[model samples]
Target: MARSQKQKSVTPTPPSQLDRFDEANSARLGLICVQERIPEDYTRWDIEFLVDDRPSRLTCISPGEYGGVPHGLDGDFATILNVMYLEQGAPESGIVHTTAYQMLQRAGFPDSGQYYQSLQESLDRLKAATYTASESWRDHKRQRWTTVKFNIIERITAETQDGLGFGSGTTLKIQLARPVVESIREKYLKPLDMSFVLSLKRSLTRSLYRVLDAHRYQPSMTAEAAAEFRINLQQWARECKLRETVPARIKRNLESAHKELVERGYLTSVEYEGSRADTVIIYTFGDLPATTPAPEPVIEVVPDAPVTDALRRYGVAPTVARNLVSEFGESLVTQRLEKFEAMLKSGYQARKKSALLVDIIRDQGGKYADPEGYQVEPQRSEANLQAATVAKRMEAEEAQLNHRLQEEFRLLDHSEQAARALTQVRMFVGREVSERTLKTLLSAMTSEQVEPYEVYRAVTRAASELRLADFAHELRYAYGD
Candidate 1:
């Protein structure tokens, strides 16, 4: 017998070693609005941001779409910067081969269809919106500050499928605007602790972190120089495109984010000086912890054997079958079979049985649940059937909890909903399983012989676990004990 050689496993770059970057102009000017959502007719014009005690102006124009300017979830623009930096090196004109799924994964978003759709929407907004920097855009090569107009992303093309041009698996060709490319090529860039940024639980906090970091750090700065950052309350609010005007309201709005950053050790303290309209908010930077906190270990959920034994006959991938079992458990077969038999009795037919079965398993909205007329006998023995009753009761309780959460989520305003969703995405990214799976997929994506289907499987499995984890957190928060 001959021994076979084993391929070496690729190690991913640790979060601290990733060395991501942000464009200085965007950071200093706070070009993307921090609010999660804004009115479709919203607009910001000639907002003044101070640099070196000098007033620099910025104007954001959407010319199309909502919020009148780039706002909220548009923070994906920062992820765009990191991706471009990794692929293009010194940013020149070219198309980089990647997928929307990869982008979502890199940004700590769930690799699910809904998030993929959101990513596409954000990309369109970036391409359509224009920014005018007045004595604000930095021309490092010319060593001058100049006025410039540009889009964050120039163009995007994706391979089409089923009349849907952009999707998770679709290949993407994104071109960075020439001005953005020139800015980077000229070295007008700032190093960002991306892991720290993504670790933040709120978009407002992340935005504040970027803006403060820009003002605190200088190319020649020592530790003493970069220790503190201060800004006028009103000016800072305007720079962030805050929807509020009153100083008190602004402080109140920022309080939660301030508390979060402080607790996370990114800031030692956030202080305010003066009163009324003349207040100034001060930020004291804190030393980061020496190491990343290890994620809580994931307790693996083994799929029920009977569920897999039944699903495998439908030609489902083993991993997907496992996921379905983990999600639907003992009821996976009986419920769908009952519904399928009902559909047949009604003279309706599925073109393909396997396709219909898979669809039925995936649909959580009860699309194939017998329409209130049928029930199937349990396929298991009497003893096993009785044992499954507990699982069924737990499932029912989960459904009720989900309903309650959905109502709670619906009561929130648009901004709150967006903020909550963003936090969930970040939380998913911080999970050990998500991190491990992402590293493996990222390594494979860069290889010469990549397997697309395998990547999809990995993404699906990770996403399933992310959904479950997110639900568990929501449950604990909503109902203690």
Candidate 2:
């Protein structure tokens, strides 16, 4: 009677130590196409996503080299996705140029080494990202379904000259992966609200926003499979990828995230009850704008609409569809709905479903293929002179484009250059240099018609005068040498 097996003792991490998505408003919902797993729960990391639901999973490809995924927060990659959309106006061909300062400003990241370093991680993650989807959407060329894989960014040109991060480089560009570019070209991508996504402050809270954004009207907060826990605490913890097992602390974080959502007007009400073994979390997606919401979305309690089901299957009630429509154009949302219908017709079903989905946009729908670090060499015939000739022509085109952009940067006026120079100064030391002083120096540079290098020197001088010595590293980039 006294024989008891040895129980494994588990150490819990604190909330402060938990990893979260700290990147500003970057959760892109394009990978929203996986199905809920069957009744049996696999890993917490593996949410029960239903095929009808169109749940997406983002597999990180070693984030430490780029400085790790936003240092434990979610949404950094999403932010990169959004920024790319803003820069390229949706995955266009070839390379698209955008300053790190511009990207950082848009993503709500301060112009600092730490955040820039984090952005680097995000860049690395995107360059190496592999997205998988459960439901298939129709591409312009072909109708696609599950088991497709692709990278987000093909390559990134960021020069950390003098270690000034991605901003100081004379050139900065992000190349969207071919498959992703095609998705954008074919109108399969979902549009996320830059302001709303950026407004979310926490990883978990933002997760809810994403899930809710995918759903419409009142989405189901019910368990994915009939046999799965409706909302088990332990399962929920795993879905959130929380290493912290301390019950009291977990409760605090949960409550805090929930409260933040309600206060921010994303959810009308959230209730968690029942025992840990058998629990349920009810979510009521509140109307952000009660006046003119899209026709009351029919709550099918099924994955009827890929974009809507992507969030609703996980109990997300998206309240931002209209805002997204007003911004990203209506065609994108319509495409998501079309994908949902196609999946339903194919009798497609995702055996696995995750409980959490961002409620930021039900209009955005996407697909993911289970592909690893996307790189496939094109087959070349022996002595392929044609390929070589084409490559040279493309290279020539790129050089011409780069030259044009550089010329534009070089000839910018005082106001524009001053603004850009000020951004650069702040990039090194969190904007420690006074704007007025930097402006005065930049005005002199413009007035004297100084070279770009001279402008750099003036900024350096102004920084030193202002007692901001940390910009010593940024000084090296003055000449673009």
* CA error at residue 378 for candidate 1, angstroms: 86
lDDT measured at residue 108 in model 2 versus the true structure, 0 to 100: 54
Clashing residue pairs in candidate 1, if any?
Answer: none
What TM-score would each prediction reach against the true structure?
0.55, 0.47
Model 1: lDDT to the true structure: 0.59
User: How well does model 2 score by local distance difference test?
Assistant: 0.43
Q: What value does the lDDT take at residue 224 in candidate 1?
A: 26
Best by TM-score: 1
- For each of the candidates, give the backbone clash count: 0, 57
Could you tell me which 10 consecutive residues in candidate 2 have the lowest summed lDDT?
295-304
Model 1 per-residue lDDT tens digits across residues 307-414:
565666666665566667666665655556557657767777778766777788678786754655665565542436536665686576556544544555566454
TM-score: model 2 vs. ground truth:
0.47
Best by lDDT: 1
**What C-alpha lDDT values do all the predictions have?**
0.59, 0.43
